[model samples]
Target: MNSYMKHGFAVAALSAACNAAFAADDITVIKIGSAAPTTGAIANLGKENENGARLAVEDVNRRGLVINGKKIKLELDAVDDQADPRQGTQVAQRLVDDGVVAVVGHLNSGVSIAASRIYHDAQILQISPDSTNPKFTQQGFNTTYRLVATDAQQSPVLAHYALETLKAKKVAIVDDSTAYGQGLADQFSSAVKSGGATVVAREATNDKTIDFKGVITKIKGQSPDVIFYGGMDATAGPFIKQVAQLGLNAKVLGGDGTCSDEVIALAGPAVDRLVCSIAGLPLSRMKAGPAFEKEYQQRFGMPVQIYAPYAYDAVMVIVDAMKKSGSTDHAKILAAASATDYQGLTGQIQFDDKGDVRSPRLTLYGYKDGKKTLLTTMTP
Candidate 1:
């Protein structure tokens, strides 16, 4: 062969080699969906949670989470459920239809409770960062998982504070009529009564209500020292404003769902001394919090919300489970998720037999100057 012919052959060989290398690193995409209220009133909570999940997915893909001795990119498939239970079920079905291997959320407890059945029947894995209702894993689905503590652990703590620390003798319960709201409300009522306080009154409200005036007026007349609301920032926010405007002196308390700066903004100065319980340590307090918050703020140009860290941890949990399972088979990955012993950003995460977070941290907070002030943590 002439010199030119030899050079042409060498070039062809290098090109072939490059093509083979590219083919070896060929991508495999597994769509992982998260269902949350991406619009409507609770969108801030859902957007924050979904943003955390999105960051985790991006990080894993950028850093190359190894799976089966190959770098695999994580894909997030986020869907909107608008915090409605029926919408949650639809979102779950849509994920299944779209062939999502796993899912990360349904922010509302009722939504999680409703959509979990769909995931269970399909044998797809799901991990919730915020849903607290115990009924989620009680059904023996084996497909449900959580990063946040259950209402069982959370509600009793709230009740103890109201009766023991605050010395509230008479208390009333109010719920949004959600699986989460009712469950936490029931637990709080029982715990306060067991702690030697009177359960003066109990009431329920639909999530769509703007004016809680009647309920506020009735509870005020009941002469309760405090009223515990088991619901989200949407109704809870306005409830606090209306209750304060109704001239009630009793302080309002709520669960993780009701802990938000929006609640404070809605209540304005009325938010002073408004107390609530939320799982895990707060963002400004976590050891991993500052870095996470800095990066998240830089990327999204917004402050990190309460549940985002937990949602970020949820993605890491799923990614680690996929690595440990040796395959992305739904059943195997789901099994591995249940077996995770992770030191997440919030804290150590270890699931109980019921797939609920075990001995997770809790922080009681009150709103001050349009921000959340961590009063104390019930450290175990």
Candidate 2:
């Protein structure tokens, strides 16, 4: 009895160990890259973008994602580009070398544009949640996609608001000289002129320029009714603060980058006179935005920044493409992604021919009582 019992127990333990090993090997892991500037002035926003992708990976794994009858686990390969174009290209090559099936990042438009060539050459799908410049998608690369409206669509809406709602006959334009900022400013300038408003002054500043006294001084003399700033909140906040300190009595308008809670923190009470626009609907207005916000805050212990929801949706879209294509092949996923019609946290996402979201919505925001308040939502 002792010999038989010992043999039976050994065989059972061996079988159990083999089964466990097989089960472990049965689950396939897929790596997706998330690139953003996590160490720079706009790091808060970049971290938010990466966190969104990380959360999506976590959620998909939690739900037991299976593709092609294989249990799948997703890995997020997050990188920091520091919002630099050269760094972005380097990160792109690194992501390609790392064998990521797709990427979601390079929040700056210039960075996205610079990195798209690498992704394109490697046949990796790249989805940018925050890059608003039109050139990112118009490069004739099938690998590029985005989740929000473009600057071409966003700038005009801001311009229309300035001309019709704010009744500004004279507008001043300032840009941070990056692709996103300068491109947005150029578009806004054209729209403003077309809307019958005079562009009193146009100025340029680098993204890191904190001292806007000289630019603001020049704009102040113009006595414009509204000053449009095309840049991120890091500079927008200080620019507005200096505008007030200089006793400029004009309203400050900005694009999606300037439409953030960070601006309120950076500009203080000067944010009261600032108006901004987001490329997508406000969190309260999104179909699943409230739930996404709650989950994001719980997971990260921080409130949702502007692009978190979009980044989350971008990852989901990539996974959705994998499922629909029934394969993880980059080409198959890219084909499927081009035809995505999923309802995401932001809204229904379907890419147009240029790999841009179709029929995107824009929201105008103003600060009330030290918080961002939605002024209006428009479709352009």
Highest TM-score: give the candidate number.
Answer: 2
Model 2's TM-score against the true structure: 0.96
Give every collision pair in model 2. Answer: none
Q: What digit string (tens of lDDT, one per residue) describes model 2 on residues 117-211?
A: 99999889999998999999999999999999999999999898898888999999999999999999999999999989999999999999999
lDDT, model 1: 0.86
Task: Write down the worst ten-residue block by lDDT for model 2.
Answer: 327-336
Candidate 2 yields a Cα-based lDDT of: 0.93
Expressed as tens digits, the lDDT of each residue in 222-333 for candidate 1 is 8888889988888888888887788878888899988987787777787775799887778877788999999899988998868999889988888778888987777788
TM-score of 1: 0.93
